[model samples]
Target: MRRSRRVRFLSDSDIDSGEDDDDNEDDGDGEEGSSAARRWRRRMRMKCLSCKEEYGGGDAGTCRECYEEAGETKEELKREIDDLKSKVNFLRLLSVGPGPAGTSSVTRPCFYDVVLVASDSIDSADSECVSIPAHRAVLTSRSPVFRAMLENEMEESLSGTIKISDVSYDALRAFVNYLYTAEACLDEHMACDLLVLAEKYQVRYLKTYCEKYLMSRLNWENSLPIYAFAHQHGATSLLDAALSLIMDNMDKLSKQEDYMELVEKDPRVVVELYEAYLSKQVNTAASKDPKGVSRYSFQEKRYTHDMHMNNIIEHETTNGTEDPKTVNFFI
Candidate 1:
């Protein structure tokens, strides 16, 4: 096939390739040199705009723009690889893997085989364990972030008490299955209802997700039930966040009685409020009239009581250094 001429104006003064080839023919290495030049010209080239790294190519292949884009793609893939490695390390930290040859106490269990006992009632010595089919289904989940959030909340002792009664065995099983699997028969009501169970059981991640789902669809009319759960069940952190959100955005939450009711439910939160009230002693630029929107100040007696609470927490730690106070408090 005949090749099209390259784009450019060839002047009479410029020497043609044909003329130059004939003159260079005397040199035996000229043909090899010309072939190498042609190969270099054909290869794709690029330049990174961010780092100014020059890469290769031409119009038929890729120009500077193509090179830069390709570099970005490589960098992006490299970052992704690093992130995956980090996740792998975390999984390893969780001690999930192969079992040892001997069943002795010295022999460490594999990832799935390892049993973590938080409650003594579980009886780890006599426990029958297996990663059930439902558990396996949601093992590597898309909801790890939610799990992390729940773990954080639980670590902070921000959970309500959980109880199941007057409900079918199937519903309880399904709910437990969902907590273990994160994929057991999910629907709007199921998600909302399970939030209660999760909150009661101190399942922070599940409860937080349910709260987020509710918040995303929050309306003045529909939020009462959710608020009631947080308040009645002792979801202190969740209740506090919800109350702040309502006070800031919802007109109905501005009433002193509603907040006082929430305060009554979780008195420790009142301690936090009392602290904030102390901090706001200097900021008197804004004055409140009726809605009680200014800083919430508490009596000096409660402020001093913080010292007593601290002393008790220290004494508990001295008595037993095994578990954190928050976890011990809950259990």
Candidate 2:
């Protein structure tokens, strides 16, 4: 009879589970033959599906079918991502050329139909606003706010100029450029300012972009103010992310200047934070008592867990790629 190889794969739990299926056996052939067969089998290894490293059955992650399916799916998604990126680059190049001079023969820059003026500029008095030239079609397509204002023939559109309030010159320029190119140079302050603009104009993509930028920079130092700002702007994802970070670092909450300011300026937000913290503590306690004998009922624990998971999903829904590298705008 042909000898069957004796081997097992290793899993993360194998070290702790103390379960070993391979048994030392003395075949009728003899102890020496059995021992040599076992040694040969131990030297054999199969390539892992996930990491591509050689492993025995003990380290196997999934069946071969599932592994191949996963690999094919990953390749398909990668191809889709590349196609989308190419489309975005094509649109940007076609729309944002250097006016009539540098435009490709395939596309020409028509005279801009409307201008956006920044109502608030750091470089000028309140009465003086900086004007940014843009195409009406691009503005309307990128922003519902601009679409409404222009389609209704609002006063600003009738005059061929839109006055954007509570925005700096540089930020307005960046905003218009992003409308055309889907790119922005984001610092914390600029991200905050642009998030406001994105929210007001109902630009979902830009809002998500700025939220991701803010989330990346979030820490205990900026948590309170960011939490409050997110709340005020109706940015649910940013609000949840900031609130969760704040809850994890509750020990230092009271010492921060913004924490006190948040309590004074928006006491309701503070109350909400405390409520979240309490719910987290309750959930933690329930989890530790796995036998359903915790102070909180299983139903209550389940409800909190569901809510927490839903909040996490909301925050993760638009975890898109990072903002592209900063590029100069075509003024």
Candidate 3:
């Protein structure tokens, strides 16, 4: 019995020894893995070149070489901008209108060859108009209208006095100054006047400038008149912006006084507004519907067709004439 018990104890001791060996191997592997993880973490940690702060690989933006290159590029761009500003300052001419003496300094025969007179100034018709002097080359370069008038040796060219009609003295002065310096102090009224002159003279730069100014100042109260004015002057950007504002507030459109005035003054423009709104609605409906057709769009089209038919019938009845050619349908 004692010999059997000794054999069992030896077998149990062998099992425990095997378990300790396996545990030692696992501990060695765990130590190696932890060491490797620490080395990897150290590699990922780096100082940011810009802020001088530690960050991991995931937080890194650019390498030191690329960051240095970006700094050089930014400095180069700043230098180029400064150079352009200097060139512009050098190219800009002095103001073309009256100087501190209340008479145009450009009137000197050596400096100026052309004079712009405001024919519709606030002054009485019998009074002499104030003439704003300008350089012919400057005017020609800025405006194609001036180029045509001057290069062809027209009556104004011969007389050296170009009479501008339907413009106030201040507006004409500002217009001429812009032709020289490409700069103007603009209020709403000045912007409107300059836009008209720019459109008439085909000065695209000034026209775009004035349009941007007006578009910046656009709001619900002034949108209708601005829309009408933009339409009249062919300012497409301003027109689209104003129309968008008007469309967004279509519910309140009829309540505005400007809407009444626009309806009375130009019914065609109102019709165009409705057409654009209907087109937008149709497009939205089409986008939402799977088959590219919507109930609202179909109903609107049918309603428009009925209105057209009614108009034609009413016209035929009033004139006591029948014309099949007048019948048209909206598709």
Candidate 4:
């Protein structure tokens, strides 16, 4: 006689429960093997399905609790109420174990640190496994245009098509690497570059991160290109948020000699903002010095004093030396 290769779960109590059936085991020779198989099936043990705590029965079979919990009758109100009660906790959606097929696990282990093809050996799963990059972000600089649109550096998305100069090449490489992996090792220089690349390439998540880093330093001097790009890209959300940010502090900023000086360069925006400020009739307490000089200052002062200013800026624009500290503000 042949035996089946597939083994079902088993339990000691199951063997005891089937003793009565064993009494009829020797009914006949031809039925002997079939009856044994049936006995074996009926006695096979398995774990409790719902609780998954130890207590077994046949494979694909339910335990007493599960069977009973199903209720003596579906319409029984007490059983229905009992069955409806669930333990409250965070809902875990991932399937949680090795599978029933081919004697293999259905999921990863607690100590598992990586993922790889089934064909790969355990040794190859560490460094060989794919993930985020480990280099600095592509966009590091702060910009006036990009700075005003962010609420949180980690969740903001850019609205337009903007390319970063003297930084795009490095930013693109770093940003693409980031997309494939979730990691980046950004420094101050390339933070904005990578951020702009993130925005340009639609890496919204990374762009958000860039925004956070930029917002800390965002000001009138650094938000223009990003704003231009935001408008160009039709980033309405970013544009509107930036405009609001600029307007919110426009009153305080108007009193800052340096901020106002640079802001006035954008004649179009200056007029618009001037009109808005006039409408509010803001009053500034930052009175000019006896020399009629402004008290507020630009943090990224290219020249400490006019005598020390350098004409060599990284980038030149229609207005003058293009500011390097552009922002991608999210917060």
Candidate 5:
């Protein structure tokens, strides 16, 4: 058998050359477009865990593992919040029921066993006053002062009426309510008023609550007065906060009206403030120039010597070797 001769429109080399030239440009452009489109598509897609929105890879946040962990943490926090809410509700329920409206005494709700009367003025002939009803068990459980007064069969316990001196009627009522409910609506004035009462009664929770309120509202205008009050009440947190604020504004110390007033009324307090300011300056200078001996070093030495002398005086007085009032007022 004779094979038929192959028919071709052009030679093999000619076809190959023609096809390669025509396809090269098209393939190059197509591949480039496809690669760019793939990259663009990738850049347009991402999942945000926080806002739960799609974003580009450029805007990506946490990885998959981190995102899952964050979600689990969020759920755990939600559960903890729910548990706390339940506990608060239970505690509220345990307190006594609300009595009849406008009643002078808590008669219907008989859980209250004691009466607290606020004596607005100790020296005045006629002073405004009010009575607050409370439970002995609740008061004793919350305050050591109340516990001591009632448990020791004092005059207040025998009479069934306790007179709380140097307190306003409203503050007394709020104090009693907080004793029962562990809650109080507070503004700056009320916070300060309650803080005084809390300190007098040794109610730690109420004192802390008032201190936090004062700290949150602290500023230059009130820092001096708050500092003095904190020192009087031994509110350490508020004292530190107020002192820090005062330290930061030391440049305007003498310019403040309260500073002059404090100086006039309490010269010892002013001296302590100066001592602290000097110490702060000395420490700052030492930190900036560790090797350089400056004027601050001499001032620091004097301050240290004064402080040591005051300590020795205090020690001698406490040990009955020196009169307590004979110690110098400055440190």
Candidate 6:
């Protein structure tokens, strides 16, 4: 019977002292024993490059080559990010507003060629609208509306003054700053105001920014008015998001005060909501049915239509008028 021998790898110092050759000679298995010793030496522990700790094959995240390549790529990306941040900071201009003691000595761009006045502030105690200074080149680059108005040599371009109506001073200032920097500190009210201004000026980037902010803050309580506002402003993404939230909470739709206000102000939008809800129900039913037949029956559709008609009629009767426009439910 042959006794089993435990395999151990020889260290560098052991090999330097001739212990490896001695073991091979003791085995007396010639080339085969030497090859086995080499294989045992090759089976050494691996260490992680990042943490510099010994780890098994199963615990290895990546090989040394891949780890080094990944490190280089990460450093390149960080450098690119830093470069972009510096470029943005350099391109941003100082926003123009009133200086200390209501003076116009604010540190703004030197070559600013235009002034925007909020029409709503024209009736203040001083009988003057606070002016916001801006550059025609920046405004034109940001919005085609400004481009057309300025490049046409209109009265605004000739006088170097533009009167913007229905906006407050703060909103006008923020709008001008965003045109220069593409950044804004948004709360719910500021988001709404900026969205309105963005839509009017056709600033697609700022409009999308405000829409994303409002979508992130969507809830059942604000859905109705937000949906109505989005619809009015043609904010398709925000409208779809708000409509989805409203669809999910259909049971509580009528209980909100905003719902009644929306119905009164824009009953057509309410009709569209019911239509969308019915369409969603039909789609859901069709998807669930293996035969692809919608389980939302005709009677159910009629019932939903009747519910919408009844609501409109109730509103009309309460207002004591038979306006055909109120009951017109055509999409």
User: Which prediction has the highest TM-score against the true structure?
Assistant: 6
In angstroms, the error of model 5 at 261 is 2.0
lDDT tens string, model 6, 1-331?
0111222333445444443463748655877877655554444345777667654343346655667778889989999899778646534444344566665643645576888889876666542337777789888999999998899979988998888998888898889888876788999999999999999999999999999999999988899999999999999999999999999988788898798888778877888888888788777777778587544484678587777768777886798765765546442
Candidate 5 lDDT tens digits, 1-331: 0211121233446445534654554665777655654553444456677667664344348445656778889989999899779656535433433344533433244565677777764345433124566678888999999999999979988877788877887788788777766788999889988999999889998999999999999999999988888988999999999999998997787678797667545545656676787778778787888987497576766666566456545555555655435454442
Pairs of colliding residues, candidate 3: none
Q: Give the better candidate number (1 or 6) by TM-score.
A: 6
Residues 138-233 of candidate 3: C-alpha lDDT, one tens digit per residue? 788888999999989699889888888888888988888778667889999999999999999999999999999999999999999999999999
Query: Could you tell me every candidate's TM-score relative to the true structure?
Result: 0.33, 0.55, 0.61, 0.29, 0.60, 0.69
* Residues 24-142, model 2: lDDT tens digits: 34345576665655564555445666667665455346556667778889989999899789757545443532334433222344466877777764345532224566678888898
User: Which runs in model 2 stand beyond 4 Å of their true positions?
Assistant: 1-110, 121-129, 290-331
lDDT of 1 at 259: 51
Off by over 4 Å in 4: 1-169, 187-189, 216-248, 255-265, 275-331
Please give me the total number of clashing residue pairs in predicted model 5: 0
Candidate 5 has a TM-score of: 0.60
After superposing candidate 5, which stretches have Cα over 4 Å from the reference?
Answer: 1-103, 121-129, 296-327
Q: Candidates 1 and 4: which is better by TM-score?
A: 1
> Number of backbone collisions per candidate, in order?
14, 8, 0, 56, 0, 0
What's model 3's TM-score?
A: 0.61
Q: For residue 12, give model 2's deviation from the true position in Å.
A: 49
Q: For every candidate structure, what is the RMSD over all alpha carbons to the true structure, in angstroms?
A: 16.4, 18.2, 16.3, 21.5, 14.1, 9.1
